[model samples]
Target: MVEKHTPSFIRKGSGKKKADTTEQFEKAVSRLAEGKYVLRLYVAGMTPNSARAIANLKKICEEHLAGRYDLNVIDVYRKPTLAKGEQIIAAPTLIKKLPLPMRKLIGDMSDEGKVLIGLDIRTR
Candidate 1:
């Protein structure tokens, strides 16, 4: 049996490789620029509540805001000062930083519809 040749991948410890091609990336970016949103999620620690929030946020991001959101999950436990600066009185709070007005949603973020509405993500 003849062996097939495969391209070798070098160990680039930088990070993940892009899943999309240039065209796809451009399309995603264009979609993002059109009514896209920037999100900052504050978590207190690695507790169950924090984990739930992260999972739910990811769910919303993937299902509704796929290519249209920039999610930043900041752990207050790691940086309590940041939390103080942001004046976060609650754990697992999602702050919509972009697309204006800056609305905040505090909870586990388990409700997809609520998350979508909060993030201004209109689905088809």
Candidate 2:
């Protein structure tokens, strides 16, 4: 295993909002040096694609993030309101809501490289 340096994570109920401005966004990304990740996955029921996404994401998280991330799986079919709130147009979308500069990835998460890049796990 690579030597892991555990970063400090924002505690639950930290009430942090997504950064909007470029400066704020930069700050958010910089905070990743010392902050944990917060992730939310939106899916439509237990469809095949959704299931695959969940599984792929779990595997990636276990490998890269391990104890340093929060993963929330939301069934949009059951929570239309939440979907609407996030303006989610596609199913099986993963949203990284914390560690500054929120990010989103839309797919089944089958491509580990793409998912890792999208989630800022691997650069270049």
Best by TM-score: 2
TM-score of each: 0.67, 0.72
Q: Candidate 2 at 60: error in angstroms?
A: 0.3
Which lDDT tens digits does candidate 2 get at residues 1-124?
1112111111221234545799766765664665778788888877888878877888898899878776767777666777788889998888898865678899999999999889888986
Q: Extract clashing residue pairs from model 2.
A: none
| Model 1, runs deviating above 4 Å | 1-34, 122-124
The lDDT of each candidate is 0.66, 0.73
